[model samples]
Target: MSTVAIFLMIAGVFFFTTATIGLLRFPDCYTRMHAAGKGDTLGALLLLLGLALYNLNDGFSLAALLVSLKILSIAVFIFVANPTASHAIAKAAIDAGVRPWTRKGGKP
Candidate 1:
């Protein structure tokens, strides 16, 4: 369980790092949102799951189970909310006439 939890935490951190890179490296808002939305959602879920597992490592108890469940619920909420929020923000950007990036020498 410890090993699994550790692996999950590491994976979550890796995704977060990749998302940070995407945010820094992407040329435009839409692409950056895509990276941030997907990476953050997955990273958060994995990290929360790891935390929940770690919480259970001491042995299963009613309180531990409850805490883990709460963590999972929060993860679920984030999974649903993040993408919806990202979509809404992207839509707003479109409404405001935000344009996608194009290469300088390429047909746009």
Candidate 2:
């Protein structure tokens, strides 16, 4: 269980790192948001799952179960909210007539 917890946490860290790199290197607002939102949500979910597992392994009590459920709930919230928030931002940008960067023209 501990090994699984560690693996999940490490995977989450890797995803978070990838998200950070994407945020730094992505060409435009939409692309950056895509990288960040997708990677971050998965990374966060994995981390929370790892923590929940660790908690359960540490103690076999009702409190541990509650904490695991809480973590799961938070993960679910992020799963729903991240995409919605990203969509809102994209919609706002579109409504404002924000243009995408093109490699052959203007500032890309």
Candidate 3:
């Protein structure tokens, strides 16, 4: 159980780091939004899962249950909001005629 918790934490950190790098390096709004939105949702979920598991280590208790519930609520909120925001951004960009990035020498 402890091993699993540790793995989740490590994985969460790795995902978050990748997300940050992608946000910084990706060209154009769509690709950057993809990196940030998806990565953030997954990273947050993994981190919250790890936390929930750690909290459960001491056996089921009221406080532990509350903590788990709070984490779950946060994860659910992220799940709902992240995609919605991403879609809105994409739509707005398209309406504004924002161009996507392409390979050098590629035709637009």
RMSD to true structure for each model, in Å? 0.8, 2.0, 1.3
With a 3 Å backbone cut-off (N, CA, C), the pairs that clash in candidate 1 are none
lDDT per residue (tens digit) for residues 27-52 in model 1: 99999999999999999999999999
Worst 10 residues of 1 by lDDT: 99-108
Residues 1-108 of candidate 2: C-alpha lDDT, one tens digit per residue: 989999999999999999999999998998999999899999999999999898888768998899899999999999999989989999999899989878885683
Find the candidate with the highest TM-score and give its number: 1
| Model 3 agreement with the true structure over 9-103: per-residue lDDT tens digits | 88998999999999999988989999998888888888888887877888889988899889888878888998899889899999999998999
| Top lDDT hit | 1
Model 1 regions lying over 4 Å from their true place: none
Worst 10 residues of 3 by lDDT: 1-10
lDDT of each: 0.97, 0.92, 0.88
- Sum up the clashes in candidate 2: 0
**Candidate 2 — worst ten consecutive residues by lDDT sum?**
99-108
- The global Cα lDDT (0 to 1) of model 3 is 0.88
